[model samples]
Target: MKVLSDAGVNYIRIRLWVDPYNAAGQSYGGGIDDEATVLQIAKDAKKYGMKVLIGLHYSDFWADPATQIIPKQWKGLSDEDLNTEVYLYTKKLVNDFKQAGVTIDMAQLGNEITKGMLGVRMGNGDINVWKNEPYDTKLTNLLKSASQAFRESSKDTQLAVHIETPNMYNYDLIMNSLKTHCMDYDVLASSYYPFWGWGGNNPDNIANIEKMAKDKYGKKFVIAETGWPFTLQNSDGTPNNISYDPGHYQVGPQGQVDEMSAMYKAILSNDNGLGAFYWELAWIPVKAGWDNWQYNKLMGDVAGTGWASITSRGYYPDSKIMYEGKSASGGTSWDNNTLFDDQGHPLQLLMMYKGFLNGYESPANVTSSADIRVTKIFNNDNVNLVNPLKINDQLNVSDFLSDSGQEYLNGITGTKISDASLKAIFNDLQDRKQSKTYTDKDGNKYHYEFWLDGQTTAEKLNNFLKLNSGMKYGETLKVNYTATLVKDKEVPTVTSPVHVTLNKVYGLNNVTIDSPLTVGESMLAEDLANVQKAVNNVLTGAQGTTISGETFKNLQKAIPGVYNATGALEGIKVYTTDTGNHYIYEYWLTTDDIQGANKDVKFGDPINVTYSASLKWVKTA
Candidate 1:
C-alpha cells in the first residue's frame, strides 16, 4: 500500500458492507474488508500520508454488475426509507472517518454503477425503476439525497462515480447513466482487465480503449482497480481458488507482471489519464497461503516454493522463474498445442506457436506415444493429428449423417426434411470433404472455409468481419482472411507509402497549393467534405459505383503521418487532401524538438513546395 502511495497514488479505496462476517462472528475472507476493517484501513492510509476514497457497497459481501443484492439489514426498507438510510449512513460514516483523523480525499457513492446502485425494489403497486419508482419523483430524490449527503459531509472531498469497463463498447451506457443521474463526479473511475479488453489480452485493443476513454470523457480518470494473476492453477492457465473461504470466500491470481507491465505502460503513455490502483494489495502473492511470514517465505507461500533464491523483490524470486522453466504448466498453458500420442508422448500438431523471433518448434523434451497419426500441417510444422481411440475417419460435424442430423430432423419443432434434399446435401458434403467448403441441397456453394485455431470470441468475430460479411452454410460470400495462431501475439507490421502532389498556387501570402493539405484536423474536415463532393460529382457524371471504391481508396491514400522518431517505432498518421495536383509534387516537412539536431521546430512552422503553372489539375482538394 505504501508502495502505491509512493508511486503517486493519493487515494486508497475501501469498500464497506453492512455485515461481511458470519452469524457466529467468524471472519469470512478478504481480511477485514468489512466495515470495521475498512475504517482501520482508511486510518492506516491516512497515517501513511495518503488520502482515502471510501466506497459504500451497501451489501453484506459484494455487489457488482450481476449481484447487487441489498444488504440484509436494509431488506424491508421502502425506497423513501432507503434513501433516508443511505443519507444517514453516508453522513455518519464520513463523520466517523473525519473524527478518527482519516480525512477522505474522495468518496465513491457506489461501485460499478452501470446498473442502478441499489437494485429494483417493490413500491406502492409496481417495481421501482429507481428513475421511475415514484413516477420519476423518488428517483431524482434518491440520487439528490445521496449526492447531497456526500457534499454536506465533506465539502472538499470529490465524489466519484465508479464503473468497470474492460472494453470500449460499454462506455456509452456509462456516459448515459452519468448524465441521467446528473452525477457531479470530479473524476471518472474505471476497472480495466486486458483479458476482458478483447476477450483475451490484446494490446491494440488496449490502445484503442485508452484513446476512446480520454477522447470521450474529458475529465480525469484512473484505473480504479486492475491486476493480473501471477500464478497458473486453473482453467485457461489462471489461478482461481475458492477453497480458502469454504462457502463465501474465494481467491485466485493469474496474469501478474506481464499484464501489470502492459497496463503500467498504457497509463503512463495516455494523454488524459491518471495512474492505476492494483486491487486488494494484501491478497497479493506476498501475503497469502500461510500464517507465519517466515514459514510462508521459506515454503514459498508468499514467494511460493518457486521463489527460494533471488532477492524476492525484483518481480519474483529466482525459484519462481526456474520452476517455470521446469514445469510444463508454469508458462501459460494456453500456448501448448503439441499433441500427445496414446503413450503420452508429444507430437507436433497442425497448429504451432511461432515465437516472435524464432522458428516454430516443439519443446525438445515434449513427446507423444500415440500411433496411426495424420498431420494437418499448418504453416511450416508438419504436426501430427491423432485420436486416442482407433478412429479411421474424421469426427467432423459433417460425418453425422445429414439425414439423421438434428438440424434435418428438428427435435425442437419436429420438422422433417425431404429425402431428396438430404441426399443432395450429403453428396455435397462428401464431394467437398477435403476442402472446408460446404454446399446445401439447393446447390448453393459457399467457398473458402478454414479451421480457426482456438481463439477468443472477439477475435473470431473480428476475423469473420474482416474476411467475410457472413457465416453460414450455402451462403456464397466473398472474403479475405487474416489470422494469428498464438494468443497475445503482436499484430503484423503494416506500412503503406504516401504520395504528395502540388496543384496551382493560391495567394502570394497564403500559398494556395493545388495539392491537398492533410495537416491538422481542420484539413481533414475539408478533405472529407470535398471527397464526398467529388464522389457526388462522379455519380452525377458517367462513372458509376463500379469504380467508387477504387476512387475513394486513391483519394484517401495520402493521409498525413505523424512521426515520433524519438520513440522506438515512429508514430505514423495518414491523411488525404481533397483536390490536389496529379503529377506535380509539393514537399513539406514539419518537426517538433529533435534533440541534438540543428533544426528547432516549435508549435507551428512554414514548409512549402513549389511547382510550375499550366497544370490542368482536376478538382482533387
Candidate 2:
C-alpha cells in the first residue's frame, strides 16, 4: 500500500460485494469482498493515508454491462424493496466505516452500471424508448435512494458514478437521466482502456467529454479504471484477456508505461481531470503452482485469490455456462497486466505511475524477474479420424491434451513436463514458428510450415492439419522445435523437440455400421445416449470439432454378422473386418439442425447431432 501511496497514488478503489459467501459459508473468491472484507481493505487503505473509493457491486459477485447477477440475499426483491436495500445497505456501509475510524473519500455507487443495476430486469427490454419512463425512473430512484443515504451517513465522502467503455451515448443517457431526475452525483466517470478507449483512443474525445461534463452537468470527470498488460506471456498458465491492441504497442514493461501514459495524458488534458486509476496493478500469482492444485484451490476458495471457488458455483451460474468454464477457477489471469511479475516481485513498470507527476522517465535499471515456464505439454498423441478433414474444421486447444505427450524443459533440453495441462501447451503453441515434412505408409508425402500470423497454421495448429493442408492418412506428424528467450536479463532455452502425431487408424472404407433393424421400434446408434457421450468425450476430445461422431454401438449383439472382428488385435472390444484389418466405426453428427428454422442452440450442445445420417471411423484403441 505504501508503494502506491509513495508513488502519487492517494486513492484506492476497492469493489464491495454485498454477500460473497454461500449458505455453507465458503467464500466466493474474487477478494471475497463481503462487508467484513471490504471494510478491512478500506481500513487498511486509510492506514496507508490513501483515500478509498469503494466500487459497490450491489451484487454478491461480479456485476457489469454484460451480466449483473442480483445478490443471493436480494433475489425476488421488488423494485421498491431493492431501492430500500441499496439505501440501507450503502448507508450502513458508510456509517460502519466511520465507526471503524475509516474515511471513504469517494464511493462509486455501482460498478459499470450502464445496464440496469442490481439486476437486468428492464421491462420490454426497451428502456431506450422512454428515458423518462418506468425503467429509467426506477433506476434513477434507486440511485437517488443510495445518494440520499450516502449524504445522510457521511458528509465527508464524495459520490462518483462509474461506467466502462467511455462513449457518448451511454454517458449521455446516464448523465442526462441523472440530471433529469435531479439525482445528485459529484463525478461521472468511465473506464478508458486501450481497446475500449475514449472515442477510439483519441485523447481529444476525453477533452470533449470533460468540457461537456463541467459545462452541462456541472460534474467532475475522471477515468475510473484502465490497464494494459506488461507482457503477453501467461505467468500461471491461465490465458491473459488483453493479448492484442489496436494501437499496436509492443508488449513489455515499457510498453505498459507508454499505453498507460497515453490514457493518463488524455485525462490530464482538463484542469479538473482527477486522473486515471490503474485497474489492477498488483494482482499477481502469489504462491500458487500446478504442483499444488488442491492447496491452491483451498487457498483460492478460502482467501479469494482465484476468480471463483467451486463452493460458490450455485450462486454464480454465468461462469458455469459461459464457454463451459470450471466453477472453481484460478486467477492471476491479470498477472501479465500487473505492476509486479508472477513471483510477486515488482516490475520496472511499478515506477511508471510515479512518473505521471513529474515527466516520464524509464527506470534506471529496467529489469524483470519473469521467466518462461513450460506451461502446456502436448496431450493428443494418438487419435482416430472418422472422416477426411474438410475446410473450416476449426480446432480447439482442449483437443490436443494427451496422456503420453511431452514438452521441452526450460533452460536445458529433455524432460517430460507432466505438471502442465494440455490446455497450457496448446495455448503456448498457438504463437510459433518452424516447419516439417512427413510421409505416410500410403507413400503420400506432405510438408507443413508454422508462422506467427498465418491462418493456414496459426500457433502450430489450425486449418493446417486438414486433408489438403498437410495431414494425411496413417501419417504421424513429428512437430520438432527449439526456442530461446530474449533476456530482459534471462529466461531459458527450449532444446528438446516436441514430437506430435495422430494416426487415422480408421477411415470410411474400413469401417461401416448398420442400424440392424431399420423399422419397427428401431434405434439409431447416434440416437443412443451412450453413443452421444462417446462422441462428445472421445471423438471431439481427440479430433476437436473436425470429426463429429459417436461409437456405432449395439454392434456385436445387434449386427453380429457384419460388425464382427473376433480375430483379436490387442484389447479389442468390437470392430469390423472386411479384410483381416479390424477398425472402429461410428455415426457422424449432422451439420444441419433437425429444424434449422428454430435457431436455439444450447451453449453446451454437442457439435454433431441432427436427423441426417453420416458415419466416420472414430478410433482404434
Candidate 3:
C-alpha cells in the first residue's frame, strides 16, 4: 500500500464477500474475505491516505458471470427476501466502514455481472445466464435496492455498476436494461482483459463506451478491472488462469510494464474515461513446498487462497470443478499476473503506474490495442485460418462463430446477422472425422470454392463458405461455401476380388441429425457495430436505424453456417498406416447419415471394403 501510494496511486479496490465458510464452519481459504476482512482492509487503505472502492460480489466466495452464489443465509429465500438482503447487507457494510472512520471513495455494486447476479432462485435458483425479461427485472431490483442503500449511507461516495465485456455489444443488453429500469448509479464500468479479447480485441469499444456513458447517460466510464500476465510460470503447485497466453506483450517483468502502461494510456485517451483498476496485483502465493501450501490453505478467511476452494464446488455452477484434482488449499493461479515474483520480491513493473505521473521511464510511443478481432479469433488461437482449406474436409459454421449465437441462425430468432454458425445449426453439427471427410451433416464429400471479392463462378455456393467463415490468405479473401450430402446408396462399386452381401436400406424419414456445432465468431458484425453503437449505444440501434450493439455482436457471434472442408487441424491421410486413414475410410462410405455413424447407419447400406494385395518385386543391377 505504501509503495503504491508513494508511486502516486490514490485509490485501492477491495473485493468484499458476504461469507466464505464451509459446512463445518471452516475457512474455505482464498482470503476468507468476509465483511470483517474487508473492513480491516479499508481501514488500512485509509491509513495509507488512499481512497477505497469496495466491490461487493454479493456471493460467499467468487462471483463472476458463470457463478454468482448468494450468501448461504439468503439461500431458499423469497424474492422479497433476496431483494431486501442486498439493501440491508450493503447499507450495513457501508455503515460499518463509516462507523470505523474509513470512508469509501466508490462502491461497485456487483463484479463482472454481465449475465445476472444472485441468480440462485427459490430452493436453489440459477443466476440469470443472459439478460432476458424477468431476470433482467430481478437484477434491476437488486441494483435499485443497493443503489438506494449506498446513496442513503453516503452519497458523497460514488457508486459504480460493473460488468465484464465478453462482447462489446453486451453493453447494450446490460446498460439498456439499467436505463429502462431507471436504476441510478454514478459510474458506468466494466472489466476488460486484453488477453481475453474483451470487446473485439480493441480499446476502440472502450472509447465508444466512455463517450456514450458521458453523452447519453451523463455517467463517467471506468475500467473497473484489467490485468495481464507477466509470466506464464506458476509459483505454487496450482496452475494459473493465464499460464501461456502472452497476449500483446512477451512474458516477464517488462511484459507486465508494457501491458499495464498500454492499459493506462487507453483509458486516459477518452474524454469521459475515469481510468482503470489493475486486478489482483498483490495476489501472490505462499511458497513452493507442499506443507506450506497446506499451511496457507488453513489460513484463509475461507477459500481466498486461490481462484476458489474445493468447498466452493457446489455453489459455483461452472469451471470451479476444475480445481477438484488440484490443491484444495487453492494455491495461487494469479501470481503470474501480479506485481510480486514467487519469492516475494517487488517486480520492476510495480512502479509502472507511478511512472505514468513521475516520468521515470524514457519516452516511448504508446499504442493501444487495435481492432484485431479478425487476427485474434481466426489466427490459430480460436480458429486457425493460416493453414488453407482442402477438398472433402469436414467443418461446420462453428468454425467461424460462437456457440451463443447459434439459436439466431437456425431460423430461431432475430434478423439474418453476418454469421458462419447458423446454417449447420439448422442442420446437423459434426466433429472432424478426418480433414478430408465432409463435415456437413451427412458426411458428404466436397471441396473448396472461394468467391474471392465479387467474382462469381459456377461454384458460387461453395465460394461463399471460406469468405464468410473468415478464410483469408496472403491478402486475398474468400467467403461463403457449400457441400451437399450424397443421397444415393450406390457410387463406384468396390474393385476388391472378395465378395460380400449387403442388405437393403430405405430413404427419407430423416431424423434431422442436429448439429452439436460449437465455437465460432468473426468481426464483421463488430466492425459495423463499432460504428452503429458509437451513435446511440443502446440495445435498440441508432436514431433511425433498427440495429443495436447486440445485433452486431450477434452477427459477430456468427454468420450463416458454412460447409468448411479445410483440413487444417485434422488433415487427410496419405498412407494406409496413418491414423487419419480410419476417418477417410469412414468418409468413403458416408451418405445421408454421416453424422450418425453406427447409430444412424442402417442394416443394409452400401457395403464396400477396399484393400491392397501387394507383391514385392526386387530388380538386380
* Residues 224-323 of candidate 1: C-alpha lDDT, one tens digit per residue: 7764433233222213332122211112211243454456566556676665565643332322322122222323322222212222222222333334
Q: Candidate 1 — which residues are off by over 4 angstroms?
A: 1-10, 22-27, 121-143, 167-169, 197-218, 233-255, 268-271, 284-621
The parts of candidate 2 lying over 4 Å away from their true place are 123-132, 197-201, 288-298, 319-328, 363-621
Q: Poorest 10 consecutive residues of model 1 by lDDT?
A: 366-375
TM-score of each: 0.40, 0.58, 0.55
The predicted structure with the larger TM-score, 1 or 2, is 2
Candidate 2 residue 277 C-alpha distance from true site, Å: 1.1
TM-score (C-alpha, index-matched) for candidate 1: 0.40
Superposed by TM-score, candidate 1 places the C-alpha of residue 346 at a distance from the truth, in angstroms, of 36
What is the C-alpha local distance difference test score of each model?
Answer: 0.42, 0.57, 0.56
lDDT of 2: 0.57
- Model 3, position 183, has a per-residue lDDT of 93
**In order, what is each prediction's RMSD in angstroms?**
27.6, 18.6, 25.0
Q: Return the top candidate by lDDT.
A: 2
